[model samples]
Target: MLSEPTFSFTNFQQDAVKALLSSTGISLLAILPILILIVRQCGSAHPAPPRGCRRLGLPPGHSNLHDEFDPKYSKGTSKDVDDKGQPLWRVKALFTHPIKSCAAVELNVADVVSTGFAFDRQFCFAEQFTPDQASTSEEKTQPYWDARTLRNGHYSRLALIRPEIWVPDPAAPDYAPDLDEVRSKGVMVMYYPRPAGRGLSSYLVKLGIALRLLPRELSFSVPLVPPPDRASAYPPVPVKIWKDTPVAYDYGQHLPQSLREFLAPPDAGASRPLTLFRVDPTHHRQVFRNAPRKEELGFQPVTGFADAYPLHILNIASVHDVAARCARDIPRLSVRRFRANIIVQGPEAYAEDHWKRILIRPTGAKSDADAGVEVHVACRTMRCRLPNVDPATGIRHASEPDRTLKSYRRIDPGDPTNACLGMQCVPSVQEFVIRVGDTVSLLETGEHCYIKLLKPGEIVEGV
Candidate 1:
């Protein structure tokens, strides 16, 4: 054993070096095939995702939707121009909320009322009633009966148009051309309880039965003129919205059981009861137009359960611009986030800011362009955290759109805090019908007066 290890140190070192080089060579050879495979895959038409993977994309305020059309081509989708050389800013899409804040119904054509789009925000939900000292708790058990109410405008979440309720009320007018029904019957968002055995038969499912949506024929939030006995029968109710406390008519007395439930939340444990009310047809809330010159735009319409204006118009480019300003890749922003009654394509990003008045014309029509519906671009729509809320998914973005917008698009550049996109609009004519694929012409151009005003406290957030 003493003589056993009499080997030379040099020989041992040489053997160790050879073993290390051989191992290194083997490792490189094994990795070479993998590199070749990756290179081959890269050359293919469609690169395959790794096995066992799901689709992924950026989230809100971080990503953008890849659209094919050129944003500046205002001549509608294609260059079919009107006699005027302006780009055709065609109506990319048209949507109507048979029920405000709920899901919107895509429409080929929709009529406009003095208040807003046909049947939009005509009937909104309120929280359940918790009777005050004037009434007893027994009222909860009574169905289709008069009781105290907590109007939806009083609370944001309750008033929220839940995308979860995306399905159109089957009772609404048929998708086919049915403006006649709108005039003859009028639209009401009704809720019919599922039959007793069918389940959900209660005013609210939490009411021990389930209820489904039903579109009924009822005129609401219009004909500002009150009934002769309105003073005594339909007492003026105190509902809060923004800074104004315009008197609202208590609509509960006339509505059926189905209408009451449809306008109230299903929360069994809520502290308030759903009380239906109508917009004060006589009163109008003025938007604070922060312009150096005092220009008087005629009577503002009374907002019907809407924030401040009757209708809101948004541009797809503006939304995309807001997303691009975001720091990360964002998910495709749905038109629902804008909650716009009208979605217009064409015009560069934020171009609507300068469009003070726009005429919506039928697509490809040359002579009837001027006769088309004219809308006044009232003001830059001031924003809050509302855009951060995804109406489609009901998911809230912690930051963005608003965060990115604050950096660029300010409602009042002087304030720098107000964020806005799109324009608050009201139809110039008393009544008109706007159809999809309509072209929007810039009728009047003016600087957007960023009004230095604050929406009074106790304001509810929108979806």
Candidate 2:
């Protein structure tokens, strides 16, 4: 009876405290070895490589070996330009068909998902006859070694000159003309014709014969159609996007208005307009009136314009500014020579000069948060002598009244040098789809950049 006497509350509390102390003691004993092992491992571990080594592969104590291979150009940083307490505005557009001039599609929004545009100069017209700089053959095909050798100065006459046989047909299922017929007709027409000494009149006459093969008398269209499904037989080609609008090719100072007007839909019931011809705006200066002496033409000269590539880029702002200045004098100065693919509306005049890259999306694209396009800012478009030529009078001079070329002192000031800020993309048939209202995000790739249209200048030591 005494042993069973009672398990009171005090007894129960003592028993519980003893059990807890025993469990904690066992747990600590088991964890001590593990904790010591972890500490030892951590202390003996090697340190990670420096950040520069991880990124640029320049390890410490090996600077001299890599100095010779270091990049000399300036890579632009990512920053936004602010204006008047408001977020700065940026614009981006795509210019496809690099080789074929006067055919561009505008993208409001585009996805710069790759290094190059989707459809970049996929098609180009090669003259049937090759030019023999060594021979006296009137029709000589220039060598196609690289883009550097294809100087605009060497082919300046081709600007307003059209392919006598090769004409684009807008009405055709594909915009390109029938090459077989173009070749046949072009050969027949030009075989007996002699090369003209001054203007491009003879080239135009031959081009008319080529236009007969195309719908609406147009000349050519790029043959970059996508295949049905994913067929193995098809070539692995870049994706492309085509625009109905004609691309403009600037040959020095000649504005091919005939080509622009020809691309336009027939007005009411008028005959199909000629696709390739010249437009001379009377208000501007004539830069090439005295076509460089025969000797100067052989050695390519710079236009003193700064462009990433050889061609000039024209946006709405630049064109509008020119129009406003000439409104009193010429009232009809259109943006013809500044052949650019994208025509942006926002930003002040020449604002694209400061951009590094641009982003865009096509018109009516789906509203997916991740669905937009981007384009890297390769170069700034600079003014050139093309604007100095008075299209109306066909007069060429460095000083012309009411000339917009004066606005760009860097280009027209003293002697005409090819100093411009525009970017020149390589001529390829890579195609890309772009649209209006697309956001352009610019990023500088490098500082010591060269224009695509012209060859790089001799690398001289610090000026």
What is the alpha-carbon RMSD of candidate 2 to the true structure?
Answer: 30.4
Candidate 2: which stretches are off by over 4 Å?
A: 1-95, 102-116, 125-314, 326-330, 359-374, 382-403, 411-416, 419-433, 441-463
TM per prediction: 0.56, 0.37
Model 1 lDDT, full chain set: 0.52
Residue-wise C-alpha lDDT for candidate 1, range 136-172, written one tens digit per residue? 3343442322222122222322223321111222343
Can you write out model 2's per-residue Cα lDDT over 80-198, one digit (the tens) per residue?
A: 44343322333333343323332233333332212233332322222211244322333435432111101222222223322221223344443333443232221101111123222
Off by over 4 Å in 1: 1-88, 98-100, 126-184, 190-235, 251-270, 280-302, 324-330, 366-370, 452-463
Q: Highest TM-score, which number?
A: 1
lDDT of 2: 0.33
Superposition error at 220 for model 1 (Å): 16
